[model samples]
Target chain A: MTPLISLLFALAGLASLALAMPRHAAQAKLGALWVARAPWLRGCGWAALGFSLLVRLARPDWRTGLIEWIGEAGLAAAIVVVVLMRRPQLLRGLPAVVLLMVPIAALLLR
Target chain B: MKTGFRQSMAWLHAWGGLIFGWLLFAMAATGTASVFKSEISDWMRPEVRMRTDPVDAVAAAIRYLSVAAPASSGWYMDAPDDRLAATIATYDVKDANGADEYRLAALDPVTGRPDAIRDTLGGEFFYRFHFELQLPYPWGRILASAAGMLMLVVLISGIATHRRIFADFFTMRPGKGKRSWLDAHNVLGVLALPFHLMISFTGVLTLITLTLPWAITANYGADTARAFADLDPGYYTRPRAGRPAPLGDLRAMLTDARARFGGDAIGRVTVENPNDAGAVLLVYRNDSNGVGYDGGVAAYDAVTGRLLSAYAEQRPAKSLYNLLYGLHMGRFAPSFSRWLYFLCGLALSATIATGLLLWTIGREKEGGLGNAFVARFTVGATGGLPLAMAGFFLANRILPVTLTGRQDAEVHVFFLVWGLATLFGLLRRPARAWIEIVALTACAWLALPLVSAVTVGLPYDIVGLGFDGVALALGGAFVAAIPPMLRKLRTVPKLRERRT
Candidate 1:
């Protein structure tokens, strides 16, 4: 399976996790409304991220798989940080709900 | 005498980062580009436009060597993969002085004919500059290693000093002068902390022997080469015999090695004593498939094409070292992973740049010649790098294709442009220098696509249109940055006048 979709899933997951944190979440007033649900959002975020890693690990070779996985994760983390800084609300519930489908689709493809 | 841990770390981070940050920025920027070294080389040499399986290319190279340097010691050929269309071959040949020297040739993989490619240092210059800074051996490497050590210290001290590392990862408040620069520095530093730490640590490890050879010297007592050979059997080099004989078909031997290794691709091939009685051929499997420096090496009698010895298994310790080395080099990375490395490298560069900017901004209120000098130097080095690189690409396109010593000329063009930028910085105000150099770099970037289209032909598969796309994108980014900068420049002067 291609790693692009998985990378997007990982980025979306990290964005959700970042937005759920009080510091980042408070940047957007909408984030404060869901601050109480941060724990649940974070858990879902980690699950999606773990699933994204699993997609990379499923490649034919372990060496490429491992390196690509870490690299993808790194890129995803940077993207999440940038997005949170610019528009934290994009990482809130609605977009997080939309992002959930990416990993689900990634899993089916795998 | 009773300084706190955070205070001590702050002192270390500030001073250490200031002293070595410029070199780190240069290394990061050039090293990021070096990740696409082969593609850049292909783009630089428009004459090399053929792509084929390396197996066929290897045959052509062997044939060329048999005729070109038949009486020489040996031959080595780096097989062309998808990225490169030409098989680069080197053979030992006697120069006009009758001294043994290596001659390199780029051959059309399909036709087995040598390509009259222009002499350009190509992307290898950037790769060399990344670590060696184009200085003399050992000294350049040693200086780079020292910078790496200083970088590691800065990173550790940065983490120690930053009390709210994770908490502040999301903080980036722009337009606060020194505060903004510090925010950017901290954010970029924290965002890619793992990547920064891994790269710096592995960079040190990659040259550990060179950095600290005392253990080897103490143990071996002046025979370090022999000691290394004993420790790592794979490092051994075979001596040529003083007898002449024709070499057997290398393709057939490679086929045998491939079959033995379950159809693995050959990464490198070395022909020892091409025309000698005691000749041998060494075939190494591509390391991309595994986290090892070399997958497996097999030795065959060059004349008879019979297997002599093979090293299919690696020691666990060596395997771990190879894996770390491979990670540091990223030679095993696929396209997407390579892009990720490039992006992380840019973040590292940005971190260094922002730290430099912060240093200047923090002292801007107490401005002096020293402050002004640092600011201008930072602007020159940071903005000048991209401009110089664009100038190098432009030089490659504009220079006479067949000019003698053209490769050295291209390097000279690079340094000359960079030196001019330094002078430009000294003469112009720091803000103006930043805007002007960036605008000039944008023009150079914008011209690349047009130049390539005129000279080489458009719709470049040279890096699968990557070179053109990146050129256009960089051009667009710089163009986008200029108008806002100009507006800022206009407003800043008025604000200063009002204050006066």
Candidate 2:
């Protein structure tokens, strides 16, 4: 159940990154290809963040909830960074990737 | 005013974070390490690992204490549970001068007799150092509070500077000059923003009395201690009248407490006014779902064997505070959560490292290394500290237990290694220095499991593959780092090639 929620959140973050991208090529070139896909990507990111929160609320387990919460926050922060650095935003996804990977890895390892 | 406000804040965030970043990183890393301090202690002590049930040892210690210190007042048993290796019992007695004296004994897990576990200082040292740095009084606490404030400022300014919060969501192009650094910082900051915020806020709150004494002074009328007492009802002020009194059996009390709480057995037992009329035994339940360092403390009347008060009965506000504290400390989490915290902590350290590296790279690109002694210090600190930590772990493994001053020697080695790393950073080229330190770090980390396997006959496989797993993971990371370090070392030639 926790993994499912985390996966959904990760997908959302990916979507948000896609949403955050600019439409035009000139701006896109300067920021890099990932930044260009920001428009949809931002949406996915926000959704992931929201879902992560929901999972935390639903799950009574503190450890899983905490990990999910951290993962969500990371996704949200990535979104915020993307919106702030309007021009080039491809690197904003690192936190989400790292955050999501931790819990997922823990689940696998455990 | 607006420009100045933004500029001042930016400056504050930058300089404050840069100055304290290394310290904060250390605190966080150590705190994270402390989440698994017991497990680490268990791995370090092989003698304790062999005994699955150290109950007999604990019973033996109780018997020993009962005989050795019969009239000495009360014995507080810090029994071994799932987490820790050794069970410690301390007897409270008064000296001829009428001062309290605590005689402590560590019981062997197998024999339950007084045994010396290797003087490695175990996990508690790192745990204590996280908040106090083992310094006297307010200094360590004050430093920690200052770092927390700095972290808060960084979080705020970092958010303000990154205007397009929603636009750049999940994007990572890796090598895009300044864009990459900004992305890296943003990603790390954003992903763990809540963690960063919660940790800092709770950290400040943990030391709230020190940070905001004005509130306590104003409300409680200059009686800060009273204010704390009000906040923490578990604190007892009145001492028991000195009289030899038979106390309730702690082992039985612990069993009752565990049954009541529906949790594991008691971890630590604290007896106040032992041998006094009003002697109270406070048995602390092992870590559970609830939050905070202070768990359910069940107080038993020494003579009556009746429950006086339980922490579970505390008011909502107090309970909420405990929960928040627990959450922040990761005390409530099971073993898995502890592991997760450990990994996240490492990532946080990596985040700081990457950020420092980006700052240096950014400045270097502008036109040679700038006169930012602060940035230089940060690089030295963030990079050098890890090397030092590895040295500490190595010293713990290598230093002979029988050697005089071995404990102090281990601590000194940590400082010496860190100091040397910093000196090397200052003396050598930054890129080259980083490569060298990283290589050293790798060697040190890789050596740990080998040392453990050689000294302790417990093969890496049977210890649930924990030590070897960590070593292999760290070693792989170091091996992967070789390419990057080599690439940075060859930067000048690459630039020349590009120009040609």
Candidate 3:
């Protein structure tokens, strides 16, 4: 359950980063909206990824946290890369879904 | 000498990656599978059901060994844990040549009797093949190390050459033939760059002594064993007493070890000279969950059941090495992390494979014997191996449980199937060979669940079902892939591509 949530967090983070890019953002449905929110989207991406690491670490201890962080980060990167290749338009909307998931995941985790 | 830095690096990357890509793919594929080795072993041997009372199984194994090989030099019991369903007891037995031969028995966790299951190599084959290549010991180790070094060089060179690597991170144009293959190669390599680098660098470190033994050789002269013993904190030996004596209760020692480790799982228990007055029991905590030089090894006077010393002291240098080695092995990873490792490994394998394909696709315009050979070889090796592994699984299910030399037969089937696939590749057209082999492999994979269901009934546990599930998914993927590939082949210019 934690892994799934953390993966969503990571996906959200990567999606924000992708949407912040001109090429992917230009292809997105809400290109102007993403462009207007580019800076915040980029920040949100990094913050989500960082929060993911924190959530992963919070599980038991630092050692396991570090390992899980690496694993979850890989999954996130893979998801981002695949999205970039196959469907750039999805990046704009993915962040919203990810943002929605984060609080729910945190609540469940708590 | 006049070539530019990027040009030189590109040359190095292309040649190095092409030369070692197949080996890297094989290692990555086998190593990925090896992540769930214990689970796969359990899935292979369906008879041994895991017991909740694993501690009781340790007691059971000790009892079995006491009567079985009391006079042996040592006894080691791999206690039944969450991953493993049976207690495995191995004891040193003197061979006819006066060399020590290890004998293994898989005992039922509850009854403590040997499980009457078909003997097979199980997951150990894949594990050993990853580093050893199923070759003679040092040669295989040396070859794997060399390949690791080449891979490290290739990775470094690849990054140095790809000036637009970051720019191309989001760039992928599929169905452009050579461009498509290159895009896939670049994307996979870039995305999993950290994983590839860590795995390669740590892989070389895992066999550092074999690759660069000069330091030890120079220090220890001809006695490298002495140096190893001095360096490794886990090394310990005590000579046997001439007088015979009955072994003490191991359950008491287990109780002491549990307390020592703060209730951490005990991975192994070793009883040295169990029937001698100098018998010593060594209990090692499973360090799969922690980064350490050695899991805590507690020594006990076997007859008296007295706790002597828990070997926890270690040099920082050795501890660092152990951490690197452990990270690469991923034996300590829980199921979720292990799946993550496996997934990354598959990506790495795909990265190498795409790189291999790109090499041939780039040379498609050249139209030469060498290019043709490379294409054919690529198809044979890449497509044939998975088919071979499927053959191994099929053999395991198909062969009679009690057939003589059944284990050896299963291994033979793997090689035979692989050989036949390679031959088929060599004889047929590259595109045709690939399609046939992949289709055949898919069929075999799809058959795995049904075969198991028919042969031994559906596996009751999740782990067993997981194997079947993965196989079916793989088969589905292959089936889904065929049409697009066939369509691509139809569109490509059909040059007279020779096999040789």
Please name the candidate that would achieve the greatest lDDT relative to the true structure.
Answer: 3
Two-chain DockQ for each candidate model: 0.52, 0.23, 0.57
| Model 1: pairs clashing at backbone N, Cα or C within 3 Å | none
Order candidates by DockQ, high to low: 3, 1, 2
lDDT of 1 by residue, B115-222 (tens): 477767677789889899889889999999999999999999999999988677667776565677788788788877878998998888888889999888988989
CAPRI quality band, candidate 2 = acceptable
Instruction: Point out where model 1 deviates above 4 Å.
Output: A54-63, A93-97, A103-110, B70-74, B91-104, B460-464
Q: State the displacement of the C-alpha of residue A99, model 3, in Å, after optimal TM-score superposition.
A: 0.8
Q: Write the per-residue lDDT of candidate 3 for residues B1-500, one digit (tens) a residue.
A: 32999999988998998887778888888888898887877887888865756578888877877777766899888877778887777788777998887766677787777747667777877888899988898999899999999999999999998888866776677767777888778878887788889899999998998889899988999998798776754545578998998878878888888788788888888888888988888888876767543657788888889877777647778788878888898877877888888888888888988888888888877999998888888887878888888888889889998888787788899888878877778788887788898899899999999998999898778987899888999899889879878987776654435422
Of 1 and 2, the candidate ranking higher by lDDT: 1
Instruction: Give Cα distance to truth, residue B281, candidate 2, Å.
Output: 1.7
The number of clashing residue pairs in each candidate reads 0, 48, 0
Write candidate 1's Cα lDDT for A35-91 as tens digits. Answer: 889888788778878877787777767567766777677677766666666765665
Report the C-alpha lDDT of model 2 over B241-326, residue by residue, as the tens digit. 76667666656665666776765656666666655667776777765545555556677775567777776545777667776677
Badly placed stretches (over 4 Å) of model 3 are A36-40, A57-60, A108-110, B50-52, B66-72, B92-101, B493-500
Global fold similarity of model 2 (TM-score): 0.80
Displacement of residue A23 (Cα, Å) in model 3 is 1.9
